[model samples]
Target chain A: MTDEGPLTPRVTGTVRIVGAGLLGASVGHALRARGADVVLEDASPSQLRLAIDYGAGRAATADDAPTLIVVAVPPDVVADVVERELRAFPDAVVTDVASVKLEPLRELVERGVNLTHYIGSHPLAGRERGGAISARADLFIGRPWVVCRDGKTPASDLALVEALALDLGATPIEMTPEDHDRSVALVSHVPQLVASLLAGQFADAPDGSLRLAGQGVRDTTRIAASAPELWVQILAANAAPVVDILDALSQDLAAVADALRAPEAVGARREVADTIRRGNEGVERLPGKHGQNRRFASLVVMVDDTAGQLGRLFGDLGALAVNVEDFRLEHSPGAPFGLAEIAVAPAVLRDAITGLEERGWKIASTTND
Target chain B: MTDEGPLTPRVTGTVRIVGAGLLGASVGHALRARGADVVLEDASPSQLRLAIDYGAGRAATADDAPTLIVVAVPPDVVADVVERELRAFPDAVVTDVASVKLEPLRELVERGVNLTHYIGSHPLAGRERGGAISARADLFIGRPWVVCRDGKTPASDLALVEALALDLGATPIEMTPEDHDRSVALVSHVPQLVASLLAGQFADAPDGSLRLAGQGVRDTTRIAASAPELWVQILAANAAPVVDILDALSQDLAAVADALRAPEAVGARREVADTIRRGNEGVERLPGKHGQNRRFASLVVMVDDTAGQLGRLFGDLGALAVNVEDFRLEHSPGAPFGLAEIAVAPAVLRDAITGLEERGWKIASTTND
Candidate 1:
């Protein structure tokens, strides 16, 4: 095993993973791939065997003494597992990978667990499915792993958790548990509920109405297909923050509905337009792939729906040495052609359009940044 | 120009396109490409000239008579344009391609305009940007073009409009004006409002909250960037139906908020889970690319983020003679590796896994269909 990247943080001793599900098994796989000692444990014997068989880690034994213990379990059981792990391994730094943070910390506080060696962390990485079989060594690569630390957390313990995140090719962001919960409630939890509710509207829709569904509805509702049982726990665990956001959203929705109901009334059109414009500004505030608010100029290029069309376009882009910041392909059902919307830095937009057009590709339009 | 597909509907004689905007110019281009005479007109001289220069069609002449007239204008101006086109060419079958069908039809009825030669159609196709510059010849190809025809409409006029949709590579589905409006309200208009309102929540979010935005929020709010002015017109034009859907959605959202606010209460968790499960079922009812609800099995293959990794994967799949039904690539920022989720027919899932694994590729997991 080779630990070859500059981002790989070094850990000297054994790192034990509890609850060998997707996140736990993945942490083990990633750590084992980096030539680190890893011990795996799970309440279910079958899951532990599967993780070990998959080369994630070896089975934990009483003789083994771990330096770090990562609690990766469902949100409902996270606090219990963390408490038990901290009690069993007094010398080990205890952390968790649960989606929710504050609830577990409060639980530990209420139970009067020692705070000296516990640091809560959440690696913002996952797959649609769960289990050891779905685990991968690179699951955390380039993802954000948030570490929750308070004034009471020991500096050494926090550093150890951050190192674990770095060793797994993740960027560790320090945040308070309250801040973590609020941030995720806005970005992750609220979006899930919105998608679910929007998709639920489709349940009683006329059959032909759904036949008119296009890419807009599909993209908006894609996450609605997530595991409902799992989401129920995540949402309930962070209910206060999520509810706060949803209540605000409900008020805004009511305002929009009122305006639409009386569109011919004075100021109704302006109200509706103002809400939409705010949405435009809100989306603009979102960071791009590089975690920056920098915008990229995009161009739509028309291409026939042939096998080599996209490959040829990418080849041409390579020949021009123009890096495509992002790409999305749009094809209508039954159309013989599709459009490739490619994003590039503003400086290279003109060059890309000229080069591609000179190479006989039709440039449909250059969209505003 | 070659028309070489089973879906290519044939039409003869001159076709007049009023309003040289995106849809209008695209219709002209598609018809002109099929060796038909197309005349373009717009209130804006500059836009008309641009569309003509872009090979959409030639400028309309006073002496020339058209067999068919297509009114492609904004929702607010659609009725006026359709009425003018009907009077200008009494012998021609007239159709308007506004997104909302019933409003314009109602306006025409209120004015008591001659309805013998008029039909309302809306092609479910568009790019983010508008105007002649964004138009493409294949924009409507493979998309659903809805034609609203009543009992009073002449069969020949309705057939002409359907032929026009088919000739432009679209599938024409006959619906009443009321049905068309209601369907678009549920599928298109309501989704737009939901996305806009959800994104609006970000306007006043805390400074660091949006930094954690993931693909889910991005997908749910993608369409919120649409032009506010244009959407105001569309929402107001179909205000009745859209308001109806929004009202129902608002009620459901309120219920969800109430449940999330008190998750520990009896049945609160069950209510939240039930709502999410209903969303899953709703999404499952949406047809796939080929207009079927057949679910495809998926396999996740790990790949480094080096250039040509996706190309190589496709090449290998081609060599194995396995058809990829759909695919999605997911990567985190600064990650050195990514996962390619490839979908294929259920019958070939095992073979694909074995073939790729033998070729030295890592198959992470096979997702349930």
Candidate 2:
């Protein structure tokens, strides 16, 4: 929810977005699609024309007094761009969308820049690629738009930022700069670093080691494809928080390794179990959809290799109106046999189990009692 | 390759598969697909008919003189069935496809029987559902079929087993039972545990935190949907190896945790970086086919929120006659702008990057160097 009280009028004006890159152009395009006037500016004349030609905005010069100015530039240059815009148009309420918050906020404060109207925001949506030509009006839809509002953020300016997020079809989340940085460090930064480190191991693999690699390792490290330079900057900025999470993960990994080397030691085995158990406990703490905890139920069915059998089973479930949450099969060795584990609602387990057994299906389970 | 000599005359005959469940029926189905004489035997008359109706196999009674007997049964009773088959059809070659070979193999050896004609095999393949009704002939295709051949496996028996893999269109990989268990522990078993641990974290999350999960967490923990009992048995049988890998992971995690708790220490940060970096290195070693590890050379272009820009970009690339491997977009704030990363082959990267830039597009990087 926006910080402003209810019944406050949202400012409706020609929202002008400078830079016309991915975020800039996407904002203009979304605003325009929603029947709002959008004007765009960029230092590159080619980018300016492309934004206009692409229908991202109506072409506008720097002289226009836009009520709101969005500075979408590179991380290294965001502070400079924001300062320049302030000098260029002092009347506008300015904001910047840089990934790291503390650095830019520090830069503005250190320079003694007037801060009453500036807010720091980051829309947590991205892809592996970048640029203005890649911008889409629907890009931010359903994503979190984090507004790092400080004490200096005026009531009017905060509402304008929130309105911009809502206009772009994003969920606006208000967070302190430190909280935002720490959370992202734990979630985004750490994952990237982990992937990069995993990928880096392959740089010195033997001839066939890589070719023989499989899906497990691939899934675990797919995020390694991120840009090196951008990550370097992000990691450098959020180093403190990210390092903390990494330390936790590393300690856990070391203990696991030591336990494997000495399985006979009961102490080590218990530690192994404890770590696994802790991971279990931690995973359970994660939120569910719309912010709720989801309960996952499971069922195991014995199956054979034959046609129409699966169809019949699913058809039977459909007949009984038992909704399967999910299902998995593990093929047993020695002959044509396997086990199928089906997940369903806890409320329906008894009926579903009985329904299958009554139909002559061998449901393999230890009695509940 | 089969164990038989380069030009040994191929011997093919009727093979009877008992049980007709996922594994049993898949054996029959795969053999049948390769034009083998597949005869199926099952206690479940309905399942027998289902297998026949699905064209998995021709029906066979208890008295057939089968060239091979494939006992696809549960681990708990693998010995009983293997011994029963041996007493019934002493001359026929016998094999069991149990996940764990040592226990079943030991059971057979303990029966004081001449096991010269018997071999053990395990094919790693499956889905999240089961039964003869769920069987597919192509289920084992392209999957690793480990043939456990050792001191007890007769030369003739090895040839027969290798021929079986060929008939089923499976890639036969020969490894000592111990090595096979270790490799799977590193690749499959440990991965399952990790995924489950990750998934379990979501069980207790507040509604808000759960809603924040994206595709990253989904893909990373997808294997969590596996059968619990089957995994229990798998991990139990390969406990030593899995424990070894987990121990390694735990050690790394612990070190990381320590670093997180004490970020002010230089050694802590460096150690954390190393662990994260190691994960990145390991990630690159993974193979990519369906989520494989193949690298795509990319061209990043800056674009705006304009109608038809994406279409034109794609059209221009198509016109360049270079295959675009993949594409992603990063939208920025302030302006509706973004950077588009387009993946192509290294061979095509130069042409594509130059071609786009020549057309007056803002490219992120034009050269790899």
True lDDT of residue B133, candidate 1: 85
CAPRI tier of model 1: medium
Quote each prediction's TM-score. 0.94, 0.65
Q: Give the alpha carbon lDDT tens digit for every residue of A1-369 in model 2.
A: 112234322447767787888788877777777777778888888987888888888888655768888888777778888888787777778888777788788888899988777888988776555667777776676577889888767788899999888777677888878777776765567656554544554555443334334445556566765656566556666667776666655555555556556655667556555555555555545443323345646566665544334445655676677765444443333334445556566777898888888886766431121
Alpha-carbon DockQ of candidate 1: 0.52
DockQ of each: 0.52, 0.13
- Report the poorest 10 consecutive residues by lDDT, candidate 2 chain B: B1-10
Worst 10 residues of 2 chain A by lDDT: A1-10
TM-score of chain B of 1: 0.95
Model 2 spans > 4 angstroms off:
A1-92, A99-116, A129-142, A150-155, A166-217, A227-369, B1-11, B41-55, B58-60, B75-88, B99-115, B151-155, B262-277, B290-369
Task: Write one digit per residue (lDDT tens) for candidate 2, span B228-263.
Answer: 545554555566777766665555555555555555
What tens-digit string does per-residue lDDT give for candidate 1 at A1-369?
123555343876999999899999999998998788999999999999999999999999889899999999899999899999899999999999998999999999999989788998988888788999888887887788999888887788888898899888789988888999999999899999899988898887788888888888888898998889889999999999999988888888888889988999998999899888989988877766667676889997876655456657766776777766666666565555666777778998888899989999988668766
**Which residue runs does candidate 1 get wrong by more than 4 Å?**
A1-3, A6-9, A299-316, A319-322, A335-340, A346-368, B1-9, B300-309, B336-339, B347-368
> What TM-score does each prediction get for chain A alone?
0.96, 0.76
Judged by DockQ cut-offs, the docking class of candidate 2 is incorrect
